[model samples]
Target: MMEERKIGRKTDLRVLKTQKAIKDAFKEMVMEMDASQITVKELSERAQIHRKTFYLHYTTIEALFEDIMKDLFQEYCRLIEQTAPDAPFDEVNRVFFTFMSRQEPYMERMVCAPSYRDFSDKLFMTMMIHNRSRYNPYANYSKEEQNVINTFLCLTSVNIYRQWVKDGKVLSLEDLIELTNRLFLHGISDVRHDL
Candidate 1:
């Protein structure tokens, strides 16, 4: 809107506004359809920014998606870190679920939208990479054991959370977290009777 001035290390306000517009438009598209289907032409139109302007901020739609994912992953790691350093794995995941439960609609869609599997998968893998350093549940077990256990723990929990969201959260968030912890600790056979 204003003349572009040399802002040095700081981002131009116009640039920030344009980026936010692009991001907001992309988010709307994600909510409306699968993320993979979004195109720059539609996003630029929706953002009311020129495609050239969009390029000034992000090289590709995938880049924008990764930018958003990085912000999300950072926030997730921060929340997970806030829990006690040596917290039990279940408790650590409780922190994750709690953070997830509090997401805004756009972010919730990123995690729970059936068409956004790539988005969700990216989020899941990012969480796992960080968790390896933060909390290793199977500490006493071999690396392979830890790998499988952590994958199972992370994957099942996120999917359970995803299913819960898709089902319109039939169980309260607290109940879902409790049930997830049960599944992690007791396994399916043990929880089958309760289900």
Candidate 2:
């Protein structure tokens, strides 16, 4: 399990914050440059950190990616927890809408860079994996059945999020949730088949 180390309480929290700032800066800078063309000096300058400090936290620009990917996954998981399983569709939609309201900006920035595309793929993978395990804890389905539902959700949810972002976030959070719930809960054959 990934330990939730609260860096804020420690002296090194500042260092951690600085590292985050550097990475955030790097992310913004890379959006404007080819990842292959981004040099350590440029990244350091963008992040406002000394070259030595950047090196201390990461060996190369690529190494910073691993850490950022981990953070992206963690953030998504945090958002998923804010949603309620038993809530009405509108309520659930609100939960997701609220979640996206917070994430839309960061995602918009991250997706602009070529280096961050894989992070988007991994984000979908992580959500699918999580949903398969915990989405409906009350449903006693076989593993194969669960896998099918997870796969469907994985595709639909990712697409919805992508569309939501692309649509300039026109829908209210509640509307997004209601639409999703209508599709999943009320639209299709409610009877889930194992096949």
Candidate 1, residues 134-168: lDDT per residue as tens digits? 65556899988877877777788788888888888
Error of 1 at 163 (Å): 0.9
> Candidate 2: which stretches are off by over 4 Å?
1-14, 30-39, 50-52, 59-63, 82-94, 111-115, 131-145, 188-195
lDDT of model number 1 = 0.81
Q: Pick out the ten consecutive residues of candidate 2 with the lowest summed lDDT.
A: 1-10
Q: In model 1, where do residues sit more than 4 Å from their true spots?
A: 1-11
- For residue 107, what is the lDDT in candidate 1? 79
lDDT for position 94 in model 2: 51
lDDT per residue, candidate 2, 54-151, as tens digits?
98888887777667766766776676667664445455445544655675454664543445656666666675576435556436988788767766
For model 1 the local lDDT of residue 7 reads 60
Per-model TM-score versus the true fold: 0.87, 0.65
